[model samples]
Target: MKTFNAKVNVTLKKSVLDPQGQTVLEALHSLGYKGTENLRVGKYFEVTLNAQDENSAKTQLKEMCEKLLVNTVIEQYEVHLS
Candidate 1:
């Protein structure tokens, strides 16, 4: 088995409302930052996994994201393997 590095990014779906991101955007505007119309917040997870090959590692990582890391009902995820 080989050790692989995985990066999981979880973000609110385009149709979902992100109150936190809105709050941050308001705060930025209040702080005098201009030209910042919209803002979005997301999460990043870095993990190390053991797999027989890159394909397996990607599959496992994708499963992990879908099962536990991301909320499919309101969120979307992108996986990166290295």
Candidate 2:
């Protein structure tokens, strides 16, 4: 078995309203961060798995994201493997 490390970044969809992100953006502005914009907040997960190969690792991670890690209705995820 090969050990694989997967990094999954979960973010809100563009059409979704992110109240937490908006609050953070307001805080940043108050802190005098003028150049920054579009501050969106989401989840990041580092998953370690044992798989037969890279393809197997990807398939497992994709299922993990779709089934539990991400909300397909209002969120999207990007996975990076190492």
Highest lDDT against the true fold, candidate: 2
Residue-level lDDT of model 2, residues 1-82, one tens digit each, is 9999999999999999999999999999989998778889999999999999999999999999999999999999999999
Alpha-carbon runs more than 4 Å astray in model 1: none
Q: Which candidate leads the pack in TM-score?
A: 2
Report lDDT (CA) for all predictions. 0.93, 0.96
Worst 10 residues of 1 by lDDT: 58-67
Q: Candidates' TM-scores?
A: 0.96, 0.96
In candidate 1, the residue pairs with backbone N, CA or C atoms under 3 Å apart (3 or more residues apart, or in different chains) clash, namely none
Model 2: what TM-score? 0.96
